[model samples]
Target: MRELLANRVKTLTPSATLAITAKAKELKANGIDVIGLGAGEPDFNTPKNILDAAAESMYQGHTKYTPAGGLPALKKAIIDKLARDNHLAYKPNEILVGIGAKHVLYTLFQVILNEGDEVIIPIPYWVSYPEQVKLAGGVPVYVESTSEQNFKITADQLRNAVTPKTKAVIINSPSNPSGMVYTREELIAIAEVAVEKDLLIVSDEIYEKLLYNGLEHFSVASISEEVKARTILINGVAKSHSMTGWRIGYAAGNAEIIESMTDLASHSTSNPTTTSQYATIEAYNGSQDSVEEMRAAFESRLETIYPKLNAIPGFKVIKPHGAFYLLPDVSEAAQKTGYTSVDEFVTALLTEANVAVVPGSGFGLPSTIRLSYATSLENLEEAVRRMDNFVRSKWQD
Candidate 1:
């Protein structure tokens, strides 16, 4: 059986985040009071309007498959979204919808990458980026960014990392794990480097609508015409509309690249869920009050828990402007608890405290741990209380 597996399949690593979440769930099934913070999804339900739209679509006989890329109405809604929200213009041909943003990204890599092509990924990236690149026969070249820098790579770092083999650079503003966002000025500097190096930009804006504080989300493509031509903009309704199970995401970019991705999707998925496509059209064009409510809820949680997390002994964290995660430096905690690695510390936390979190090693940082605040405030409060007690019990003083 091992001999029959493809080389790609053999080399791939399973998603550590999902594995941790599953383990916590298993414990909960056995009546353990586990407070799992490993999952990166909103705790909110899909808004009633979006649900009503899906039901309406099905009731109107929209259950059939759509075009492989997406429905025209959805595409147009996405176009309007890009223009209205991000200040970027696009035609329907410039977009390709898929099962989700993750699938859209996988398809994008498949279409753009050749054997051994290199993609520049910053530290603390989404868990799936490197694996998706590997699955496409592309090499992931990681650039490390320290916690002191808020886990963001600089233009000089990007310039130094680019080689002749480098095909693209991934920028995830309002980033996952760390929840750090690159400022518009920072993006301008990186865009200058990309333009100078003639590298493609893969901008993953899945968390764009989840921004907090006074921060703003900027699209690298909106910087200039030249940069826009080289940028692949990826987004979806999963984060915005609480539609993770809806499985609708899309990409917009150079028409040729989008067309190639659409063709690849046609063979791979045929089309996104037809009902999801219709639901997402409403997600885009419908009232955005629900999106704002969810965003505010996440922001309120961050405001509450971030300080509590920092107050825990040996846990150092910077307040982040956007997203629902906090990647806290827990090396001191690991040392005090007689663990050699953060991964070991995470395992101990789950086993002893029944609090599940993701080790930063999966996101390319070994000394930190990520806790998603996407769950209820009650769960977060209890999880942190357990974490604090665990740390105190292990304190050497």
Candidate 2:
């Protein structure tokens, strides 16, 4: 059976984040009291207006297939969003919508990468980027970033990583795992490198709208015309509108690349779920109040829980400027707890403390751990209390 599997499929690793969340669910199924901080999803329900729009669309018989790229109206809404929010303009032909941002990214990589091509990915990146590149027969060239650098790769690092085979670089602002964002000047510097090196920029801005602490989100494409042409902006309603299950995400970029991705999507998903597309339209064009409400809730949690998390013995955390995750350096904690690895520490935490967290090994940083604060304030406080007690128990000499 192993010999029968394709090499590409065999080389793939399961998403560690999902696996941890599933393990937490399994524990819960056994009637254990597990406080899951592993998943990155917002705990809020979909906004009523968005739900109402989906119902209205279905009531009006919108349960048919849309164009492979997306419906024209949805594209228009996205275009308007880019223009109004990110200050970038695009034609309908430049936008490709698919089943969630993950699918859109996979399709984009499939169209853009060839065998042995390299995509420069920063350390502490989203788990899917390297996997999707591998699935597309491309090499993932990782540029490591440290906690001292806020887990962000610099322009010099990007330039140094380039080679004859280097085709693209992925930039995820308001980054996952680390929850750090690159400033506009940092983006400009990186964009200049991309422009100079002729490398395509894959800007994953799915968490663009969840910024905090007077920080602003900047689109790498919005830096300049040359960079805009070289940039592929991947975004969706998943993070912004609490529409993760809605399965609607789109990409805007070079028309030819988008067209190729759309064609690939045509043969693959056919189109995004029709109702999701309609609901996303309302998500973008409808009242933005719900979006703000969710953002406020996340920001509030960040403010309250960050200090508490940092106060835990041997745990070091920096307050994130955006995104709902806190990636804390728990190496000291692991050492204090007599664990040889972060994975072992996380497992003990889950089993003994019943507090589920994602080990940083999956995010390419083994000395750290990621805890999502997307749940309620009560859950977050309780989870941290459990973690603090767990750490104390291990070091209670």
Residue 56 CA displacement from its true place in model 1, Å: 0.7
Residue pairs clashing in model 1 are none
Q: Give lDDT for model 2.
A: 0.94
lDDT of 1 by residue, 215-315 (tens): 77899999999999999999998988899999889999999999999888889899999999988988999999999999999999999998999999999
The sequence of per-residue lDDT tens digits that candidate 2 reaches over residues 3-51 is 7777898888789899999999999999999999999889999999999
Computed on alpha carbons, the lDDT of every model, listed in order, comes to 0.93, 0.94
lDDT of 2 at 322: 89
Query: Worst lDDT window (10 residues) for model 2?
Result: 1-10
